[model samples]
Target: MKVSIKHLFAAVTLFASSTVLADVLADIKPLQDRWAEVNYALPEDDREKAFAELLANADKVVGGNPDKAEALIWRGIIKSSYANAKGGLGALSVAEGSKADLEQALKLDPTALQGSAYTSLGVLYSKVPGWPIGFGDNKKAKELLLKALEQNPQGIDPNYFYADYLAGKRDWAEALRYLEIAKAAQPRPGRESADAGRQQEIAALLAKVQKKLKK
Candidate 1:
């Protein structure tokens, strides 16, 4: 079979692009793994310190790959997780940084990491104090979470975060529905630790939502 020169060039370009993407993922995998470890396995009292260290690594990754959406998304996730561990007013700045990272990731590639930027940013909007304090907005939170779900219909993180948002809104039935879906999500390869941790969260939320429904 004879291939046209145009077709040959296009094939080579496609292969190069795929190789670069694979290398990017490889570079970011450590950040993702450490994040899950710190967020899920560390003791509460120790998590803040661990997350702080992880944030340094994440910053380096983002710095090295400024244009890689996956790197930015993982950095955002780490910052947000660090904020959660830090808690209180002291964490607000870190949260804001997280929001910025995720927003940039969205601009670069909204669908990267299965729309994780939307999921994480939606959770931030839902959890942060609103008005004079932070940029929290329930309306915007729901919009972003819904978009995340649209991108990752069977994703554990998206479903769980959206369910948490619904529960906050006192929408018990809807929260339960999403929680169930989250609980049944397929295990993500190379993410067993994260999947396990998320499953536990889903179980706890499921129980709470079910109790609310019974009331």
Candidate 2:
């Protein structure tokens, strides 16, 4: 079979793009896994240092693939986690950077990584102090989180985050429902450690909601 030179070049270009994308995603996986470990298993005092190291690596990933929304989403996730770990006035700068990364990711591809930008942004808005303190807004958090749910209704992160939002609002019944959905969420392929760690969080939160119900 004879192939035209133009067709051959196009094929090579497509393959190269695909390969690079795959490699980028692969590089991000361990960073995510380490993040789950640091967030859930590391001692409180150790979290900041661990996240700082991970953030540097995440910055490289984002810098290497500025056009890839997937990379941007992970960058935002790492920044947000790091900000949470490194609280106080110093943390706001990191959180703002995270918010920018997420916003850019959303603008590039809202559907990337099953809508994780929305989830991360939602959590940020929900947790950060509002107004004179910071940019947090419960209303914006609800909007973003629900948008994330619309994109990935069955996703563990979406359900878990929404449940947390509801709990913060003191809407116990709705929070419990979402928590149950999160508990029953199917494990993500190749992310067993993260799933397991998140499930532990779900169980702890579930227990809290149940205790609240009894009150």
Candidate 3:
């Protein structure tokens, strides 16, 4: 049996690409773990410092793999989480940086990590103040969140963030539906901590939506 030169070359290229992807995932796993730890396990008063430290490590990862969408996505996540922890006007700058990182990740690969860039960016758009104060736009947030749901219908982050958006819009019924789906999402391997933390958030939101419906 003889393999054509073109076929051999293609195989080699595919293998190299796969290897690079594996390396990127391996490198970002630590970032992901630490983020969940800082965001969930740490006390609220302590999280800002922890997240700031994590952001430094995330910066190194993004710098090392500037083209890896996964790395950029994680960096963006860390930045946004740090901003949330910091709070107030001072945090807006970090949030803007987070938006930029997520945008870059989208350009590199919109579907990387199950469209996480879209989910995270959508959350930013939904949460931030609009116009003079910030770039938030509910319309853009819905569009991005819907795209993320299309890409990852059953993903925990997509459903959870979309539900949060819907809740913000006072669409209680729709929010409840998505929160239910998010609550029941299958846990991701090697992301047990994140899954657990997100489940807690989902439960809290679910209670809020359910109470709103009863009101």
Candidate 4:
């Protein structure tokens, strides 16, 4: 029997895509549990199918309404998360869709949903790496994260995301500041313990980053 490299590559790609989808869905399960009625019990592969349904539904809804904005935001968010789950497969579609949804949301009303549009963009940017992950814009990520914070100075979501961003840049001090700020916000049960564990992880990573910076 003869082996073809192309076939091997295809198999690997399929495997990798499957793995990413599994992991992303796993991560979302908790979030789904937290948001009971808002989330559905659909398999990962059916996410795009759901998005198509949502887009069709949105078309019937009135544009420029707060409700419309909310619908668009969530549609975009689901697409983004699904794309992420697929490890860049359909990522361009997801990123573009997310932007369009948020754009429509902003056009409807920039202040709608407590600046959720900005927060969603920030989430998209933070998770999807810049220049490599199809449409990750770290600069825009920072700007949107800041907007989210300004919109809700008392929210933990923004703080947690911003802290994650700061950690990505290896800015330990700044990340620590944001993490500490997030600590004061309402935490999920045992989240404080998780945060403490994460703190230790950050400390370890920062030590390496600092050492590399020195050399």
Candidate 5:
């Protein structure tokens, strides 16, 4: 078989891409696991240090695959989580970096990880302060979360985040509705830790909403 130079170059490019993608996935898996552990299981006092370690690892992943949206998404997720753990004026600086990473990820691939960039960005917009203090916009939060739901209508994350947002807006009935949907969400195979943690959150929020209804 006589392989032309163009065909050989194409084959090499495809193979390299696949290999790099595999490497990126491999790198991210452990980072994800550690992040879940730090966020959900570690004591609140210890979480800052643990998240800092994850941030370093996540940075390496992003550095290795600067153009890969998956890397950027994970980096954003880790940075945001780290910010939440830190929780102060300084935390906002970290969150701002996270926001940039997520926006870039959306630009690179809106559908990566089933629109996780949208889901994460939605969470950020909903939680951060609005206007002069920060860039949080409840309206934009709803829009981004709705886009996430359009991509993964039955996804636990989009449902739960949206529910949280509604609860913040004092829409108890709608919030409870989505919380129930999140409670009934099917678990992800390799994301057991995250799923379990989120379920705990869903249950707590569900209880709070129920209490609110009774008031």
Candidate 6:
């Protein structure tokens, strides 16, 4: 048996690369959780300052790691900056950038990034409409949500987004199922809000959405 020096070097490099990726994947989630908390705490009337903070953090996430897939998730999220709060053709500009990032993320690694790219696209579509139009699209939303679920059934964002879509479509049963899954995935209290307030709000909204859909 003859093992060449090249083979040994290649094996070492692969191991190192995998370790780096694992570390990044591990770190990204906590950052994501903090950002989610911040988003939840922000007042309902506006999302600009929150969006600004979100974009800044997301940029940091992408900047810290040059990996295409990892960068893509942050980029996709940043792209949808004010789509939900101040949507219009103006918001469309941001959405375009977000779309590009998610697409790149998918191309790089559809399975990695915890299906973040797909989940983000699902979220954006659910909140937005057709091109040059407003911010809302059920069909596209459903498609992306299913894709995200297919990629990562256990992911929180996917469950949240998909659950929202189901509620939008008046599928209360399914929506509840997914929302429960999302809640179970991480019960941690949001940092943005003092303590239980965020939880109460989220729970209330979930209940309201479910009730509306049930009717």
lDDT of each: 0.92, 0.93, 0.95, 0.63, 0.92, 0.70
Worst lDDT 10-window in candidate 4: 31-40
Ranking by TM-score: 3, 1, 2, 5, 6, 4
How well is each residue in 1-215 modelled by candidate 1, as lDDT tens digits? 99999999999999997897898899889988888888788899999999899889888888888998899999888888899989999999999999999999999999998999999999999998998998899999999999999999999999999999999989999999899899999999999999999999999999999998998
Better of 1 and 6 by TM-score: 1
Candidate achieving higher TM-score, 3 or 5: 3
Model 3 off-target regions past 4 Å? none
Q: Put down candidate 5 lDDT per residue, 115-203, tens digits, no spaces.
A: 99999999999888888988889999999999999999888999999999999989999999999888888888789999999999999
Number of colliding residue pairs in model 3: 0
Q: What are the per-residue Cα lDDT tens digits for candidate 4 across 103-173?
A: 78777766655677888788787776566546778898999989988987656667767877887887867
Instruction: List, residue by residue over 1-215, the lDDT tens digit for candidate 6.
Output: 99999999999999998998877766566656655555566676657666766776677777877565876676577557545555656777688678777877888888765677888887777776765475457787788789888887865667777877787777778888887776666544343342244345447658877677667
Clashes of 5: 0
Error of 5 at 59 (Å): 0.6
lDDT of 6: 0.70
Estimate candidate 2's RMSD in Å.
Answer: 2.5
My TM-score estimates for the predictions, one after another, are 0.97, 0.91, 0.98, 0.57, 0.90, 0.74
Off by over 4 Å in 6: 1-10, 22-34, 44-46, 53-67, 131-137, 186-202, 209-215
**What does each candidate score in C-alpha RMSD?**
1.0, 2.5, 0.8, 19.8, 2.9, 4.2
Q: Which pairs clash inside model 3?
A: none
Give per-residue lDDT, candidate 4, residue 72. Answer: 63
Number of the top lDDT candidate? 3
Higher lDDT: candidate 5 or 6? 5
lDDT of 4 at 97: 77
Q: List the residue pairs that clash in candidate 5.
A: none
